[model samples]
Target: MKIAVVGATGLVGRKIINLCEKYFDSDVDYSFFASSKSAGSELEINGNKIIVQELNDDNISNFNISLFSAGGEKSKLFAKKFLDKGSFVIDNSSAFRMMEDVPLVVHGINEEIITEKTMLISNPNCTTMGLVMALKPLHDEFTLKSIFPTSYQAVSGSGTKAVTSLEEEIGLGDDLTPDYSDGFYERPIAKNVIPLAGTLLENGYSDEEMKFVNESRKILSIQNLIVEPSNARVGVKTGHGTFCSALFENNVDVDEAINLISKFEGIEYWADRLATPLDAEGQNDVLVSRLRKGLSNDKILNFWVVSDNLLKGAALNAVQIAKHVSTL
Candidate 1:
């Protein structure tokens, strides 16, 4: 198989490359591509350094599968061409996610949607990726009616530059901090939280927040499922934490729910301890804990979710989908 990783220098893209080296067959031919500024730079994988190609129409084809973690605009520009040229495009951007024809996939949840006919696939936002993985088994058992999530996103999700802004503010203090500068968030992110993670839309929901609302419904195959989402940027370097309150159509069974999630494939639950982003950092598993009652209602339950925004949230899930699709 021939594989390509777009946005090869990025945090998510680097992880995708590492996993490709680990899981891809020894005979697989792999390449990396990036923006013109980063095009000639080197990305090292499995002790070999490979030069990144500039992303353009001429150079994107001839690959069996192309994993894209470039921003939405670039994915919008490049994905279709790759798909049209017979490379299965697994996009890690919100660009094609809400489209009717595109399949937004989580590896185990709705991965069956990626058929031999599917040329393009959408990977969910990093935050929503963890959220839906934890919700699927519960949605299967009790039939989810509504979900509310408050996400604490890490700075790494914003990309390499945002990480620099955060580091500068942390390492050097206030003098370097302007009101807000390039690649930094709207406000500071050191030892403080910014209530918004994405641009505020007309509906008062940030784009990051709506990904939870929109992508979860799509991945769980629940068209009518209602989601209320709140997103914030924290000072953490990696891993995103989400606290969720869910309501089901039937009465919530704590024991049965616990069993369903604990035994469910991709997520793990801890009964005695609360799971944090620190515990989930650098890990692919969605660490879920804190199952309890909310609103004192038998139908409502609360849980906490954590996962590395780069690994499971972006790269691993994309590769897992590609792996599953390769078998069929």
Candidate 2:
């Protein structure tokens, strides 16, 4: 199979290229794409340096499989063009996720939903991916009624610039603080936490918060499921951690739910301990721990979930979808 990776110079995009080279069969052909500024640059993939190609409609039309990690604007303009050229698209951006026709997939959870007809598959946001992996099994055992989630996301999710900003600030030592530059983040992301993720919606929730609410429902096939989310940027580097309090339609037994979550694909359960962002960094599986029963209703349950935003949230999930589609 021939594959093209869009936004090849960016953080998630580069990771996708590396993963494809490392995991995919040696017979597969790989191409990399970036903006005009990054074109002609060389990127090493699987011990070989590959030149980055400039992204254009013509180049997009030539690839067999295109994995897009560029922002939504780029995806909105070129995704259909690639699909029109007989290429399967697994997009990591938020472009076509909620479209009625697009399937937002997490490999272990919804691989069965993919088919040859699924020419365009959407990968959910990093935060939503981690939460759903932990919630899906419980939702299956006892239908989910509502969820209140608060996310502490890492700086890496913001991109390479944000990661550099954090590292630069941390290098300034404890006495001297680094100032926020307009190019990096809206506010200082070095040692502090920012209460916003994406832009604020008319409904007063941030776009990142709404993504968790909407994308979770779409991926889990739970319509009319009420979700309240608060997304914040933390000082961490890679993982995204979420705390969720949920109410289920049927009474949920704590022990049973814990067991079910442990067996859930792409989830690791730690009943007696906690799953921290540091523990989840660089790992693909979503980690769940600190289970608690709601005070008022036995149907209510609470837990902490964490996963690598770049892996489960982006590249790994996109690659898994490609693998799933190849099998069909």
Candidate 2 yields a Cα-based lDDT of: 0.87
- Candidate 2 structure quality by residue, lDDT tens digits, 11-126: 88977877887678877877888899999999977777889989886666456678999889999998888989898999999999999999999888887888898899999999
Q: What is the TM-score of each candidate against the true structure?
A: 0.95, 0.95
Highest-scoring model, TM-score: 1
lDDT (C-alpha) at residue 158 in model 2:
84
Please identify model 1 stretches exceeding 4 Å from their true place. 173-183
lDDT of 1 at 285: 87
Error of 1 at 56 (Å): 1.9
* lDDT scores in order: 0.87, 0.87
Report the C-alpha lDDT of model 1 over 1-328, residue by residue, as the tens digit. Answer: 8888999989989999888877777677778999899978898877778899999888866888999998989998888888887888899999999999999998878888888888899999999999888888888888899998999999999999989988878875665554645438878887768899989999999988888888888888889989989999999989999999999998888888889888988889988888888888878789889888666788888999999999889999988987876776
Pairs with backbone N, CA or C atoms under 3 Å apart (clashes), candidate 2? none
